[model samples]
Target chain A: MTTFAPGRKASSSRRHPRRGEELTFWIFLAPFFVGLLIFTLLPIAWSAVLSLFDAQATVYPTIFVGLRNYIDIVTDPDFLNSIGTFLVFTVFIVPVTLVCSLGLALLVNRLPHGAGFFRTVIFLPTACSYVVASLIWKLGLFNGLESSLANQVLALFGQQPIYSWLNQFPLFWILLVTVRLWLQIGFYMLLFSAALQRVPEQLYEAASIDGVRSSWRMFWSITWPQLRSTTSAVILLLMIAAFQAFDEFYNLVGAGPTARPPLVYLYNRAFTQQDFGHGSAGALVLTLIMVVVALLQNRFFGFGAADDDSPRKRASRKKVAA
Target chain B: MPGIGSTQISRRQMAGILGLGAVTPLVLAACSGPGASTGGGGSHPTLSQWYHQYGEAGTEQAAKKYAASYKDATVNVNWVAGDYASKLNTRLLAGSGVDVFENNAINIADARAGKYADMTSIIEPIKDQFSETALYNVQIDGKYWGIPMIIDPQAFYYNKAMFSDAGLEVPTTMEAFYECVAKLSSGGKKGIFLSNTDGGAGFSSTMAWATGTDIIASDNKTNGFSGDVDALAETYSWFRKIQQNGFGLQGQPSDWWDITPFANRKIGIQWGGMWSMPQAVKALGDDVGMFPMPPSGSNGTYALIGSNWNQQVAQKSPNRKAALEFAKWLWVDQKQDQEDWALSYGFHIPPLKAVAASASKLQSGAAKEFVDAFTKYGKATGPYYTNEIGQAMEDAGTNIIVKGADAKTQLAAAAKKIDASLATLQ
Candidate 1:
């Protein structure tokens, strides 16, 4: 203001010119930070404390139980069984989602037109609430009624309706898997499609010139390498989601002993039984396992890295190592 | 991204003040309730009441109608939906907003947490008016915690036409009942529908009790399967036989509580409630008949479960006296509302002795039959038997009946789990 530089921009001439912008930025973001602190961070911190107390029906605790809650949850056979359920879900959903989503992406990319329409159609299911979808699955589609879509398939083969596919053992898994796949596959497919679109065509042309005639070979040599990071992310997300599955399982099957995942188990323990102490402990255990899993994923896939680990970067890293 | 601060200050400041001024009155007023007293000035207190969304139509309006009749306070009836138990319990624990609520079961843990007010004082005066049996469910540790509203007995409502077509009598024994079911199931028609998902969930304690085993023994702490373990196993085995052979409606659209499955002709025999009889009779005409969960042997142990819903006031209510007074006025003092609530909307037995005696709808036909069976065999678990225990019982029953698990093993494990749950209460 006293003597403005002639060559420089007005903002650049002053030291720390963004001080006003910074304050304004904070003013805009302050409400969100306050909300996050109150809602999420505070509750998480409180849960950690609640896990150490003899919190029964009330969240407010009077007695300190130390590691007793943890001991009880760990030794509890039901908690262990829930882990098995989570593992079974992870095994079913992860790789299958990865392959199926990738396949859909490739097929849609090859389409001459209407790619957006197809993508929108597939992604629409992702917008559906889990509770609504679960009720429909439980009462409408997979319900044991003769008019149900599941029984209609059996009817097509000139057979009577199958028994409640929900309560039965092996058949129950089919309902769980199919409903989950239908809900999530479309969204993952979009992610893959976006990644596929970003992929460079030069690699494919090089592969073709190198006498790689088969599409399968080209995919393995070029498309496969390009899509590795996206595949890892999808796998990581699917695994995390499988662990967090509560709304669908709780709504559809309820707290079925053999079918309950860890979150559902924790919910029953916390909310149903009103043993918030044990439930909090079980929840922390699940959170720890998930954190460990995410860390492992980061180690294996270089996920969540600041810079993108694109194929060219990996090749450059290999060159540097050489 | 330009801030309002980039503009002149006077207009923005004035706008801010105007906005706050406009919102202040709106924020302060919460008296626009469904059944708020019109004549009462702003000096009167407002009491918040809660009720789970009842399946029957006009229930919410009837509740609000009853609330509107109360001139003492502005009573707001919050018709809660989806997981009402959890919401009510959480609110009660938080010691805010909730004043009065309706619930069928009270967990001992909640009782310890001071979620429920001790209604012994209110109920002690009118103790003789309520049905003696209905009093047992809400009584905890020799104290009444809730005011009984409706005595809902869940029984099997069957198509009388199908019964006559198959020449079947209402079986007195479980074995005979199985035979009747097998005979009725033919030509793609199902014999029974338990709303298999949760059908017979409440009767878990009854299963043990059927074999002279109390789920909670007289000692009040231990599971009571030690005496008749083998008998309980046989009962489970017989149920497995019934569930597998008969074209049992596995997973109907509606559960045992709802009348739709039985009324829709989906099953010949449906494990439905007495409230469903009017609808069933209307749908299936005079062709509907009723029976209890039949006795296994001559031991006189029929698993005729008598469950009820009750109105309770919160201990931490801001105006506890007013809330309790309103609850008493509606459920206890007002006999007409209780009678109307029970009989008009759905066929439930009036918990009040005077109302039940005077209500002519329950005197004859299927309603009379239901009353007679309930009188003879209707037994309820004590207040100590929480929903969690019931759930574990259902899980164990599912294992034995559907999954083909060994009953002895499953029963033992369930008993152990139940005992552990009881132990935590101590």
Candidate 2:
């Protein structure tokens, strides 16, 4: 059963074990790297090349345009407006999602029983496909048909239900925010709940001794500061999710100028119009913006970077261990 | 996309398998190529055919049956459901097993890129038998790129009983149509459904035609919207009001393509196509009726528009000659299959004039009315009106009506963008 393969352990005990472990580690990692190379890395590099061409109706680049696609996508008003939509969406969604999920986490955490039940109930929407959820929201709930559940509620109050929900400006935003929140709040709430459980019980006892008796005061003085890392992570995730939002805007609103985001705009430009050149350029630009935003977020929050790294704290920890 | 199952051969064998994630499936399906082309390069060559999922029952079966009957090759049919154009375009670009497929029309740009085989030779001899509108959809630069399969005309399909109950007449003008919507909407019943969202893309595209102007200018120079901007705006303003006020059905459980909302009496009028006729008649009996998109004024014109699905073979298909022969046989040579396609599953008009003329199911009642309307007012967007141009128009319509942007400003912006798009074509 002796083997010559680099990753395999030698049958002779005299052979070095370290080489086999190192080789085995690489062998196990090869599939993921291969997948990354083939699926992700190749397409991205190709997409970069595609951005500089006048390619249309085909994947392979034909005529070299040399940043013409970039110029067109940048100068385009619809694309600019989509960025504005992204900003507005992020501004509305991020803070609202954080507050709602945190509030729900607190309420669920305080429950004497059924915390697991409430958690499951809240988390179920996250399991459903975004496409399926968006379809249900558009076609079933907000379809604006007189017999639709939304309109039927209005009927119960003897009021006429006649508004075209998806087309209206404020209503469109309201419905979008609501559906997205419903789909994501449970998952974020669970994150908060997990962080909440990790907060030391001694902190609450110490806070009570300090005259911070009110629950709101106790949370603000102690719990809120303790959950800063989780909050920063949540905010970062939420911002990325907001930028990537496409299913609801597309399926519910049907690619109208009123609701289109960058992804939807890029999809239409590339797939719908068969203009791969511009689509690739537009995608790279959006990716650039996302990277900038993430960098800015890291600078502003300093969440993981600033935690307990002071020289005094390091010395104190060493003293305690000694 | 739809899994091409329920085939008479073996449902499990002809697998149009969907992969993980919604968007990922489109890429996976396209990248994987055609299904079950076993025995390729042998004496028995196989041709791969694809189709968008038709809402009509038995259409998939009919497609598979047509493929099975072709003894020259083992034809594998893939029935794609949503967003078929993207999937088809990606597949054609991959130069995989895509031998032949159906689409609204063969994209001239794609053909110019050498993706589509010129169908002029296949269609030339039988040109006289095809409908003019059908030919216009698949023809470009004086060369045929696709063979017309079916002419699906979309128009107003109203509930006869509901209209009568509301003491209304079939609207013949834009004003009367507005009045009908307002009056018919009461007691939990909606007036109309022009798709479930964006107030209907079909309605927006045909609005200019309804106002006595074609979608394109003379010699395919530019869009005709620049000719009559005010008429476009005023009509759109009215549409906005109808949509905003809830006279029209917006958020229906089903799309305007389905007549279920109409049949269930939730809507008095529905903007539907000829394909929904059989189900409408079966459910509502004598309750269904047909009409055109009403003219804007005394000076305006009646109009209707639909995507004419055309069949085309790929230049880089696995077996191009066999693929061409199969397309020619099923779409042109087999008169019985053509007639059955036109009449059996749904009420689509066969491209062949001979088949359309003999379709008995379309000779009387609801089907006849649909045919009459189509014959009189059927309109097709010019080849110049590509997706970019069409999207420019749609964006203008959406901005004006939904976002409440000034119509003149929106139209001007649209005009500028469309001019740029048209510039690319030349």
Best by lDDT: 2
Instruction: Summarize candidate 2's per-residue lDDT along B308-398 as a digit string, tens digits.
Output: 8888988887677777888899999999998888788888988888888888898998889988888888877756778888888888877
List the lowest-lDDT window of 10 residues for candidate 1 chain A: A11-20
TM-scores of chain B alone in all candidate structures, in the order given: 0.89, 0.89
Identify the leading candidate in terms of TM-score.
Answer: 1
TM-score of 2: 0.88
Residue A287, model 1: Cα distance from true site in angstroms? 0.5
| Candidate 1 displacement at residue B307 in angstroms | 1.3
Candidate 1 chain A TM is 0.91
The candidates score, on chain A by TM-score, as follows 0.91, 0.88
DockQ of 2: 0.40
Provide the lDDT at A207 for model 1.
79
lDDT of 1 by residue, A137-254 (tens): 8888988878899899999999989766767778778878878888999999998998998889988888788888999988887888788788888888999999999888887777
